[model samples]
Target: MTGAVATAPAARTGRAPAPRPVSPTARQMRRAGWWFLAVPLALFVVFMLLPMGMAAVISLTDYAIIGDTAWVGWQNYARIWDDAFFWTALRNTARYTLMYVPLGLVVALGTALLLNRSYRAVRLFRTLFYIPVVSSTVATATIWYWLLNPQKGLLNVALGWFGIDGPRWLYDSQWAMTAIVLMSVWAGFGTNMIIFLGGLQGVPGDLYEAARLDGANVWQQFRYVTLPSLTRTTFLVSTLLIIGAFQVFDQAYVLTKGGPGNSTVTMVYYIYNKGFGSLEMGYASALSFVLFLIILVFSLINARLNRPGDGGRVRRRRVPAAVPSAVAAR
Candidate 1:
């Protein structure tokens, strides 16, 4: 009877009720969710992933963007090792990084420390300081080109007033790269200043008071308290500055066009000249990958060098605890 009750319930219900179909609203919602995800996913695949894949594939070949592509696996990479221009560009980039990173850090940290007060005009000063950051790179380059002008520029004119002869800046190979570095630091320090300011704010005020109570002087307090607190911020700013210094191209393009003697031909400028001016896309791609490896190695080294508790490369020694005065007397 129970089996019959279970078995015949559908039969007894006559023609078993048809399964309920999904509501139009529910189906529409499902479709909407899919469409919403589909657009960005499709864009990511098409724009980002596809281009990277194409670049990687092309880097192995000899494709000039106009003719047949020949697969010459690793040949482009081998050529990069032998390219003198590549080495020169790498050296210039390294020199720029060395000059820019330290100068940028010092200026940014100094400005941030100066503006870390509670005065009313601080905000106004910060806005003025950061105005250069917001200014277009091209505009800044053009203005610097005028300022560094060999004859009529304001910089040399100011130096002339002091009875000092200023060297030709952008026109001279020796000074062209230095001029670019100075201009970059001026236009770029504001962003790092803001970052350092944020880090300064995060430091505990109580630590300063404690240091003062310990009879620590201003320099001692700064060395022990402020610097220790700023390690992470310094690492962040240095990494960013290094990356930017390596990729510098726009200023070179606008001011010197990588001349007076390729003094300002950075890695990116080299890549750009190879890719566009020389029309060697495959070789250009290979150069780009080399630069990518160089950047990755430096970045990894920077990270390792600045990792927490590394003391920024100085090892901290554990001093033995002092013996009791009574024990010493015995």
Candidate 2:
């Protein structure tokens, strides 16, 4: 019995096999993945995150490019309250946004609608329209600058044929901002038009057919069917236009230099002036944060306003159910 018990115990205590070592190929793949991750992580830390942190810290100090730095603790932000020029820049930017956004929407939507249909020339037209978008900002600005020349410009010359006197565009303080708005719309609408075109394609043909079967006119079909479908696209285009309008700098800088009594000075141009022209890096950083906050607020507002819903409440008529003859008889 003791011998049997010993043998049973030995059988139960049999050893398990050892684990296999990792292959060199698997180890090499793991090393390669680490290497792949290392560069981008290092770049994000060095360029993006580090710069943002430094800018935030700098915003609290008085760090003129050539002078001793002093911690001022929100004095720069306080100064923005009293800065009349800053307020003017803000107003100018607001005005540009107001003018640019609506006009851009109309033009982009119109062009998109016109080109949405199939035709032999459609591709050519799209390419031509998108050419301006691909052109550099400097190049477009240069072209517009020549076209807006007060006396010798093509615009006034064209107006002359119509027997209408044209006002000075870029040179006139009253019209400089207006001219800039026109140029901006023309140069930028192509991109949004493409977006609208894409949106138009996604709209179901069955909806339009149903609307027509219900005796809906073209305008009604568009109002009820097309508009609801393009809600997200419109939101996207409007948000982009708002952001671009606020950050307008290249056109104003290249065409007018915020000249003719600063009529065209935008918030971004103001920030650039403060940071580089005046060498007030700390103040510039503070102003930059203020603009950032404004953009963030507007973006949030846009998102809230355009949040998904049923588009509109379209009520369908409900029919009464028919009773069975046997039940009725009973």
Instruction: Looking at model 2, report the run of 10 residues with the lowest lDDT sum.
Output: 319-328
Note each model's CA RMSD in angstroms: 9.5, 9.1
lDDT for each of the candidates? 0.87, 0.87
How far does residue 79 in candidate 1 sit from its true spot (Å)?
Answer: 0.4
- Across 268-298, the per-residue lDDT of candidate 2 in tens digits comes to 9999999999999999999999998998888
Candidate 2 collision pairs: none
